[model samples]
Target: MTIAGSDSGGGAGIQADLRTFAFHCVHGASVLTCITAQNTQGVTRVDAMSPEAVTAQFEAVMIDMRVGAIKTGMLLNQEIIKTVAKKLVAFGCGNVVVDPVMVSRAGAQLLDDDAVKTIREQLIPLAAITTPNRYEAQILADMEIHTLEDMQTAAQKIYKLGARSVLVKGGGFTNELKGIDVWFDGDRLEVLQTEVIDTPHTHGTGCTLSAAIAANLALGKPHFQAVQDAKNYVTEALKYSLAIGQGQGPVGHFYPLLNRG
Candidate 1:
């Protein structure tokens, strides 16, 4: 299941997550925490759900369905983040994947300082794996990432924050380091790479990657292998990126289906 905000443009958040899940032949469920009026250009308006509404949606899903894995995205505020962390503990939910949506690739701050603290203290410790982009990793790890070694160090530091594993994505890197990612479990530290697809239509890449990881976990892939497979999946999806909007577009979630036709 994906707990995230809604993107009316259908490029990221709940829309991209569900598409990625279905691409893996997994049933997708959702609990929306907010709604955003956004397109490739950018977000114009955001309306967050109350904590009570989020809780109601969470309980309704957890009570009846047998969820295999859970992926969280765009948790709007501190109250909602707290509510989600508490409920996940209450229900003993495992295989949780947390995509820390605190910073954008362009260095924009998405979440406030207090909400970031709540995620660091509460949500991350519960994550089976936490995926943070370069800027987000810097915030969580409290260091700048310039080289691959820096990414490794950031991953190790973030691993200490209680996630079973940390993946520091290097999508913001230029030249040879582009598409490289550093993975650090408590024991192993490794770099993951794929051939960079040169395109401006790379919206939703982070959300798609993390959701693919959760879907693979639901399919019983081991943790390290899951990240490897997801990296490969996103690489291919980027090859078919959509050039729909005036600005950045999205990766093709249904590339296989598109290829079939």
Candidate 2:
């Protein structure tokens, strides 16, 4: 299941996540915390859902479905973050993958300090794996990430925040660091690299990667294996990224189906 916001543009948020789950052959369920009026051009408006509505969606899904794994994205505010974290614990949910969406790649803060603190203190610790992009990693680990070693250090530091593992994503990196992700479990620190697909249509990459990780976990792959497989999946998907919008588009989540002959 994906607990996230809605992207009306169909490039990210719940839309991208469900598409990713479908590609992995996992049944996708969702709890929408907010909605965005956006397209490739850019976001024009965002409306947050009430915490009660978020809880209702969670209750409805958790009762009927046997959610094998779960991923979270674009949780809009502190109230929603707290509500989701509380419910996850109450339901004894496991195999949680957290995509910390607090900061943009360009160093813009998406969530306020309170929400970020709630994510760090309340939500992320419940994650089986927490995936943070470069900027978000800096916030979580309290350090600037400028090199591979810094990424490794940040991954290790973030691991101490209680996630079973931390994946410091390199999507925002330039030069050779591009597409290089650092994974740090309590014991192992490893760098994961994949071929960089040179394309501007990478809008949903972060959401898609975390969703793929959750999907692989649902398929019973081990944590490290799941993260590795997800990286490969995202790399391949990027090869078929769509260039439809005036601005950045999205990875081709249905690439396999598109190539069926």
lDDT of each prediction vs. the true structure?
Answer: 0.94, 0.94
TM-score of each: 0.98, 0.98
lDDT of 2 by residue, 1-261 (tens): 999988899999999999999999999999999999999988899999999999999999999989899999999899999999999999998999999999987779999999999999998899999999999999999999999999999999999999999999998988689989999999999999999899999988999999999999999999999999999989989999999879999999988887794
Clashing pairs in 1: none
Off by over 4 Å in 1: none
Question: In angstroms, how far off is 62's CA in candidate 2?
Answer: 0.5
Model 1 C-alpha lDDT per residue in residues 1-261, reported as the tens digit of each score: 999999989999999999999999999999999999999999999999999999999999999999999999999899999999999999998999999999988889999999999999999999999999999999899998888888999999999999999999999877578899999999999988888899999999999999999999999999999999999999999999999989899999989898889
Model 2: lDDT of residue 196? 88
